[model samples]
Target: MQRPKPAVIDRATALRYMGAAGWQPDAAATALLDKAEALVLDAATPRAALRLLPRSALPTEGQGNDLRRHLEGCSHLLLMAATLGGELDKLLRRLELSDIALATAADAMASVLLEQVCDALEAEQRTYFLQQRGLYLTGRYAPGYGDCPLALNDELCLAIDTVRGCGLAVTEQHLLSPRKSTTAILGAADHPVTGYRAGCATCHLQKKCAYRKRGITCADS
Candidate 1:
């Protein structure tokens, strides 16, 4: 839904991406990010969709107790998918042969750019859900985020008509094709919800997460 012309790649986010590789990027990482961001914007085709479902339909098995508790208050689910298409993958492949370091930096910049696209998509959907359905949205929760089962990746295909609707597919390994795409479920409620923590802190993977290592929370990331 949002290809955000030239992704507003910030220094902090680039550093966080480098931190994922167990390193850090300089303030000038944007110099490199500019190149990748340009390639992504030029090649990427952004698209998204919103599907509403009853809370009972979400998967429960293949998850830990904390995740069960995390979903307790929700009455409905919102299935959303967004993709930057597959063009960037081709450029990334070429970049891989040209320079590994540049490829790594590009990968990091692409990840942050994908997040920005998702953020913009979510913001638009959040406003629409609140205005039209009178529902407050819990932040977007993706499969493999926290203890949610990676198995749900396939299920989303059915629930959201993923391939036909959004040009996304999940491999047997559970990775989304196009690499830059994302699928998430957000909590929908009739009124303001409480007693729920949000962002990366609420994630089961937060302890070992590189983003958290640098003091970044999920919502901010």
Candidate 2:
């Protein structure tokens, strides 16, 4: 399959996600975004591993209603991710310091970089899938949502090899390393997506989400 062109990270969008995470882009965050971009560009490849299997093959059993709904409305599901390793690991380690003051800068930088990378990946994936037919991206729906089990991360990792190339690894406790990486299922719909919301505003769990309390809105147009 042909790979979509990389999405340019507009400064506005970069700042939006960073701000949502309570991160202001300082010199450190700019550095992290640059480094993360290099890493993602070098490691990204067109993953044909995502076969359009029945939603039943999603590794979740109780997804009958949700899967049925998604299938009826979606044209394809796009899965894109990379393993996090090397420089990325070192970057994350630096951000994991116990001292609040010491780690704040690093944490902000990591947050900005992660969101930028995911946004770029999502844009590219959406374009590629959309070119194939009457499909448009509804939005990315990750595991651990309403009924989507976190256990499905195992299947996601196996299918995408997110650990090998991108250096992203999940812990025994099922937490993704780097604390910045993500695995999401992007549903392709026949109808056009008119809105461009990102963080908490577009999130279905916003009302009850702790992240929303921090003043994060999904208004990333």
Residue pairs in collision within model 1? 200-218
Q: Which stretches of candidate 1 lie over 4 Å from their true place?
A: 1-7, 20-30, 194-208, 211-221
lDDT (C-alpha, whole model) for all candidates? 0.72, 0.53
Which predicted model would earn the best TM-score? Answer: 1
> What TM-score does structure 1 among the candidates reach?
0.81
Q: Per-residue error at 212 for model 1, in Å?
A: 6.8
Candidate 2 residue pairs in clash (backbone atoms < 3 Å): 83-166, 83-167, 83-168, 84-166, 84-167, 84-168, 85-167, 201-218
- Model 1 weakest 10-residue run by lDDT: 193-202
* Clash count, candidate 1: 1
Please give, for residues 1-221, the per-residue lDDT of candidate 1 as tens digits.
Answer: 33454435654676566764434546576467667667656777777767889887766545654445555677888888887788878878889999787688777767776777788877877899899989888876677775566778888767888888878888998889888888887777887653244445446687787666667665565
